[model samples]
Target: MMLTIALPTGRVFSDAVEMIAGAGLPCDGLASPGRKLVIEAGEFRYILAKPSDVPLYVSYGTADLAFAGGDVLLESAMPVVELLDTGAGRCSVVVAGPRSQAERFRGHASELMGLKVATKYPRIADGHFSARGVQVDIIHLHGSIELAPKLGLSDCILDIVQTGSTLRANSLEVLEHVCDVSLRLVASRKSTALRWKEVQSVMNKISSHVKEKRP
Candidate 1:
């Protein structure tokens, strides 16, 4: 019985794999030198995918489980059962902009004059500013949202701030923290029902490992 897990491919991949290994799961495949997107370790088949696609894979039952950031869930809005907060890949969805614009935010309604905001997470950005009763012209970009403010494409950027280095380097400051993000283990409803014991065991191992790392 093989359990397929979707592993995000990128900087977070190594961290996520290490956490899985620490949970007593075989994760040797993650270290193999190859371009292979799929690898087998113990009873699990790990599939490397973009973080955004992990939830889709799990929701569609192509992968039984996955670990993704809470921000991804908010952006993708895929239906998946969140099993645990793995406490890895911590960051925040934040509204940021150039020094002047950041200060103008929420200070006066006058700043709303065709206010521009750039972000890859448009839905998240839209909902955030809307909830605050701030009307903004959200410019959607696939990457380099920080560049938007610097290039004058937008007044600010809504993006994931991991270390705040990107914002600082780009001469931007965080105006508001929309939400905190961390890696979360998710399983499809079908997987939960069909592999109840397996899923439960994996969840327990992961939960215990996370608890052990707590201060």
Candidate 2:
């Protein structure tokens, strides 16, 4: 029997391939894509999927396993089993804006009021502000969240910070770090029960490879 795995496509795909290769499941076709989404390596079959859709594919059993970001897993709320944290694509979700406004917020005794905040993550933004007793108007944007504060669309922005260069380039200062984000491996519940031995073997291989590569 062949196991079908979904790998996220994009920047993280390279690391996923490295990990998969290190696990002894070298996907040559994926290593050098040629308009192919599906490929075969030994007894395992692989599917390339959008990062956000990987979890959904696995949850519905379209794919037995998937690689996705921890943030996507939390936001999607899919009922997939989180098997491992690959520890790559490290980043932080943060609240940031102009240094002047940030300084004022630090001195303010009252909860932030009547402020419009922009973010790609509405759930995270709502929860973060609510916890601080702040009432905010959330402006959801697909990209360029930093432009919100710069263009006066928002007083603050909630977004992922990888290198802090983008924030600095936009004159935004990080106010607080929300959470650390990383890539994670997830598997379907049915897959786990139906192919326990096979799944364990593959997982063990990948886990051991990860341990060996770590500094």
Candidate 3:
């Protein structure tokens, strides 16, 4: 029986492919898939998808397993079995805004009330602000969230920050940290149940490499 794995096709793609290869799995051509979305190597069939779509593919049983970032998983809220922290694509989800808003963000609860926030992660932004008892008007955007505040579209932005370079370039600064994000190995619930033996075998092999990488 062949094992199908979904790998995200962006910043974390190389890391995911490397992890699988290091685990003694065939991952040839994954790093350079070119225009192909599906790749086959030995007993493994790989599905290339957007990071945000990884969970959906796995949960729908289209792929038996996948590697995705914690941020994407949280935003999508798809039900998939999180198997391992692959320790790839490390970053943070944060609340950020213009430097001028920093003091206002820190001092005035009144200012925070019904604040205008822009983000690609609506669910995550809502959850974070709601948990803090702050009401916000969430403006969902596809990209360039950092421009929201400057463009007078939003008071702040909740987004993934890798090195703070983008934020700095946009004259934005992080006001609060939402969560640390990293690539995680996830499996389809049905696949885990029906193909436990094969799934467990792959898990064990990957786990060894994961353990070896840390400390």
Candidate 4:
């Protein structure tokens, strides 16, 4: 039986491929897939997709297993089994704004009600603010989230930050840290139930490698 795995195709693609190859899976052309979206390696078939789309592929059974960021998984809210934390794509989901707005957020947070918050992860942003009993308008943008505050499109932004360099470069500062994110292994329900043995075998190998690499 063949196991179809979905690999995110962006910053963490190389890391995912390295982890799979380290787990003894063939990764001949994964590092430089170029235009090829699919690659077959013996019993394992790989599907390269956007990081945000991996969860959808696994949820719809297009791929049995996948690696996705915890933030993506949270925003997607797809019904898939989270198997393990691959410890890849480490970052933080944060709420940030310009220095002036940061001052208001810190000193008079209540007065900033209905402040516009821009982000790509609307679901995650909404949940975070809602949980905090704060109500703000969520402006969903596909890209260029940093520009929102500069253009006055939003007073703040709830997005992912890896090194704090982007925020610094944009003259923005983190007002709150929402959550830390990392790549996670997830599996479709159908695959987990029907291909239990195969899924378990692959999971065990990857899990072993994860443990070995952990410090």
Q: For residues 58-95, could you state the per-residue lDDT of candidate 1 as single tens digits? A: 99999898988888889898999999988788999998
Off by over 4 Å in 4: 107-109
Model 4 lDDT tens row, 6-114? 9988888888888899999877787788899999878878999998899999999999999888998999999999999988889999999998876676765576679
Give each model a TM-score.
0.94, 0.93, 0.96, 0.96
lDDT per model, in order? 0.87, 0.86, 0.91, 0.90
Which residue ranges in model 2 land beyond 4 Å of their true spot? 107-110
Deviation of model 3 at 139, angstroms: 0.4
Query: What C-alpha lDDT, on a 0 to 100 scale, does residue 159 get in candidate 4?
Result: 92
Between the candidate structures 3 and 4, which one is better when assessed by lDDT? 3
Model 3 RMSD in angstroms: 1.2
Candidate 3 residues 1-215, lDDT tens each?
A: 78999999888898988889889998888778999999999999999998888999998999999998999999999999998887778999999998888887788567789889999999999999888888899999999999999999999999999999999999999998899999999999999999988888888898999899888
TM-score of 3: 0.96
| lDDT, residue 109, model 1 | 60
| lDDT, ranked from best to worst | 3, 4, 1, 2
| TM-score-best of 2 and 3 | 3
Top-scoring candidate (lDDT): 3
Model 2's alpha-carbon lDDT is 0.86
lDDT by residue (1-215, candidate 2, tens digit) is: 78999998987898888989999875767798778999988788999988878989999988888888877786677899988998989888998999877765775525477778899888888887788787889998988998998899999898988899999999999987788989888899999989878888878888899899899
Error of 1 at 192 (Å): 1.1
